[model samples]
Target chain A: MEEGTASKRAAGRFCSICTQRKPALRRPKTLEQICRECFYAVFEEEIHNVIIKNHLFKAGERIAVGASGGKDSTVLAYVLSELNRRHGYGLDLFLLSVDEGITGYRDDSLETVKRNEIQYGLPLKIVSYMDLYGWTMDEIVKVIGLKNNCTFCGVFRRQALDRGAAFLKADKLVTGHNADDIAETVLLNILRGDIARLSRCAYIMTGEDGPIPRCKPFKYTYEKEIDKYAYFKKLDYFSTECIYSPNAYRGFAREFIKDLERIRPQAILDIIRSGENFRISTTTRMPEQGICERCGYISSQKLCKACVLLEGLNRGLPKLGISRIKAGNDGSGRPDEEPTRRGREVERPILESKPCGTLDF
Target chain B: MHLTLEFGGGLDLLCQSVKIHQVDVAPKDENAKLTMRDLLAWVRSSLIKERPEMFMKGDTVRPGVLVLVNDCDWELCGGIDMELEEKDVVVFISTLHGG
Candidate 1:
């Protein structure tokens, strides 16, 4: 059945369940027979169960939902607010948005999130990249160059979310990462052979073991479903991606996985299941968790990569500490040249006796 | 013989293209001989452009590089310690976050 394809005004397709005129795009990766409304119902049901089964939400927990004002997050807010009301989840729901200082994209998205806060009747907390990091994303990208925007966003956003959650006194932080997102991550880790991350990221409900348990209520939901839900529900969300995001490796993985999924519909799910089955023994020297000296976030080292990179950005040497942030483009300040290691509080004993009278030292 | 080298995401920028000759794998000089550790060192110095870790012959591979044999992931075996056969495909990918 070529459902809805034969309609005269193919520019707009009627969602049978919601009876809303959805813009006729190519049918989703899944079948088009399932109207946007039905997909949303299915999406919410799956999320509710994923949360309930995992005990993701705790009793009297204050939840800070990370709302980027994107479709995924906007739909997350709608579902979360609805779930709180219908099930009396007793969740103190609040919107926590990180304005990454992307000129057109983040600015527009935050506007949508603001409207969503009013519509959902949830308190909103807005954090800006400029306020927190002393540099806007655009400015950082210009200085640091195009290679590490995702690193900037991901690290900063993670810390930003935690800060916002803390400000809200949130017991739990909810993100809008869906099944597709997770599955792509699984593939990327597998491709990288990152056993530690592969092992840890397998679980649907993550983030709570350390400080504030971050949960993904939309873990089981697909991107198509999230888009459909936002469309049918008339939820406002940013349609455009962050301009810098196209070059991100995660985006590459996402595209690769999506292409593979076309060949085998179960590819995405299979990858995620593999991640679930995969386990890392404790014997492996995984990145040990340590508290950041600058910000108290758990990291592998004393000062987290975020703090080190921020120090670099602020110091006008944007490539420091981790090369992943620089993507190996340029050796901005080699450790051999600088007297101080990125996180080293004091010079090594090896260096103490050598440089008493050097003009630079 | 030729071995295809693949890299994921950010590493793709380092060696937009990489080719390690099969002869280079079995060099006469021990100093010139390449191990998985050497590759990591080269990548750390050449591609990663960061402070070189004190990498040795048998330390665990950084979670970044994925040494694949043909099309298969070495994790299916011992991982990191999986010895390289001639013309073995080596694919390096970045650690991902999600599930």
Candidate 2:
């Protein structure tokens, strides 16, 4: 509708969206050549539309954005705040980050999140693995080594976010899970035969039954778009692979989805659609959700994944709960091991469950 | 020809962590113009100090990397065949990094 931003005269082609400024970048989803100004308009507008269409937010409601200081979350926090003011959404916005306590990886990214708090003029709340779990990721990795350390980081981070949100008393939590991330999760769930997750991976809104409902406003947004948006805006963001789990299982699925996007960008959304359409059989037995006896968090077994992993670390048998196989009889694995610490604690066996995937937040 | 190269979105990690490089790269033949395909090879050998696969696959940049020639998507100017000129500012940003 209007011309803005630095001009990019690519082959003298004009923006397909606005027809005023010269085209700057070719969009992956529609392959339309758009100017930077139009890109901003559409990019911001599409996210706003998603928020409206999905009823993700309401006026006067406080929403906490899960910030990792990475490109996706950085751009997400910036854009969400911008839209909140520009559209008069009247929502209370803040940044919530989890410190995994990794030496170099998390320490550096947390600096960016702190910068974002000042730059975006939003309040920031950070909960650390040390404070919440009483052990930092560095300490956990030291005890368990790098093999299944992600399982610990992933599970701890998930709870850290929830606890952080609860501390802020925010009504809902939003993460920057883009279309590419959701698609990759869909593929991974299908490959792992995780019917429970496969049924809900593509949902724009999830965890409504929990204490704090979660929303993915960027559920339809592309990662490349996030990268480019951050680039054009010169938004400060951190980008470094986590040193501990560089080859996390989700990395392969991510690469495969990116390759598929290159061949056909719509493949990403199509895969999400497939995930949404998947129907679970009525006869299939699903794990019953129950309160974790130890931590009081939601768990399918007697204890939550966090309690199980933490107890493992405390017992010095860090691999106790990592086995994916369901030990048929409860309390069978390491029956005689009493939790060295936590005098009142009675250790319980955890059922077979998949740890959260590593999608780099 | 003299040109400015900038790496971002964690691409600098592959190149000794130096973000900007100003260099003179000669075309394989003085009579022919230099293309992105040539510059890519030059950067891979001369600039990228670490994992080259993270920046390239086969001849072109891997699927998630975005290349901009003078702030324009390289695809607009003929992709890998885009001709390079003096003092051109080419940016290579890898979108595959953590976020």
Candidate 3:
């Protein structure tokens, strides 16, 4: 519903949460006019409630927050650290980032992540595509051009985060994915008719069966709320769109979700609920679980997406991994295989939503 | 009316990367109270140096763009129709930017 701020129009109105101070925000999720103090309280409290309800963490758990130094991740890092300290969750938090090696874009954003490393007092680790896949996005774009480059970056980043988290020996990975992002993914998966991801895109936690289990503390939280939180709290975050993949297929879904949010803010949550409840028919064959024989990363196919995409780049055949469908097993795994080595922090970029066009794996 | 306008969440990039603007916004017609609608038009014509579409859709902001008046939500202050006062602080933040 379009928020009825006019009905309650007045800066003098007390906050709905505290009923003391002047309200500063109309919470998109609940349409509550809350003051700054109450906004911080409920925002953290709600996330705490979500964490407790979902049982997302344990006392001694080492959690790696997938930090891109963007508004969502930056705010997520700040709030997660705040909650952990305030609630005595006893979680060891670390910041993990993937460098896609986009020259101008990632270099600057990575600087933000570094500052966050100190500001939040969390240890930080970054893995780069140059190290992991032997190709920067700029290098890949030169050969592959802009068409479907997101596929390569998206595929590689999924593996990179897992690898980075694994390197940190973290029990679970947390990302800044919020309710709005989940809603957009639900719509994108449906539009693509990719039933596999559509079934689990709304999940609060994913990858439980694999290398690194990832959770979104903001899953039920609104994106606008996150923005307000970041803005009001004065969190330092990078906001430039990724240099590559400026107008992506996902952008359409994002814009559509935003439009829907303006018309009906509850539609964002409703969309997530719809995504969470979709039941795949028994007859539909889901992709079986498999590890990439190449890099040992988790994959449904014989070779994981990163492996296929990397091979495509290395072998001078960029389209080899460009499939919107399951990347095929058309070619043999590379004869030369090495352990998941330490990728040098060569370069990278991301921001706005889907920084570096990070799609759901 | 004298107003303090702030741009953030990448909106500042449209206006020569300046985050805050202090400008005198005179009522277009004698003594008519200045609403956000008028101020937006003024900002678009006079301040926003690029990508006006990112800031305005029709007479209001792009749907995801938030307007706050004097640190209070513009939505809570009647949104686009909200009237301004002397030295009022209006903040525009685009929540559409990814984190």
Best by lDDT: 2
- Cα deviation at A352, candidate 3, in Å, is 33
Candidate 3: regions farther than 4 A off: A1-12, A323-361
Q: Which stretches in model 1 have alpha-carbon errors above 4 Å?
A: A1-38, A324-361, B1-99
Clashes of each: 2, 0, 9
With a 3 Å backbone cut-off (N, CA, C), the pairs that clash in candidate 3 are A1-A264, A70-B99, A71-B99, A72-B99, A101-A348, A106-A348, A106-A349, A352-B98, A353-B98
lDDT of 3 by residue, B1-99 (tens): 778999998899899999999999888897698888999999999999998988888988988887888677788877888887777888999876667
TM-score of chain B of each: 0.52, 0.97, 0.96
For candidate 3, the TM-score of chain A alone versus the native chain A is: 0.88
Q: Mind giving the per-residue lDDT tens digits that candidate 1 earns over A2-33?
A: 23323322334455446674422223334343
Provide the DockQ value for model 1. Answer: 0.01
Q: Report the lDDT tens digits of candidate 2 across residue range A249-315.
A: 9889989998999889999999999998999899999877777765566778776777677666765
Q: Pick the candidate with the highest DockQ.
A: 3
RMSD of each: 18.1, 4.9, 6.0
Give one digit per residue, the lDDT tens place, for model 3 in A1-361: 1134333456347888778877888888788888899998998999999999999999999999999889999999999999999999999999999999988888999999999999999999999977766668887888778888887777778877877887899999999999988999999999999999996888998878665788999999998888888888888999877877666888778878989998999999999999999999999998886656645555676676666676665545667757554555554333322222233332222100111111364
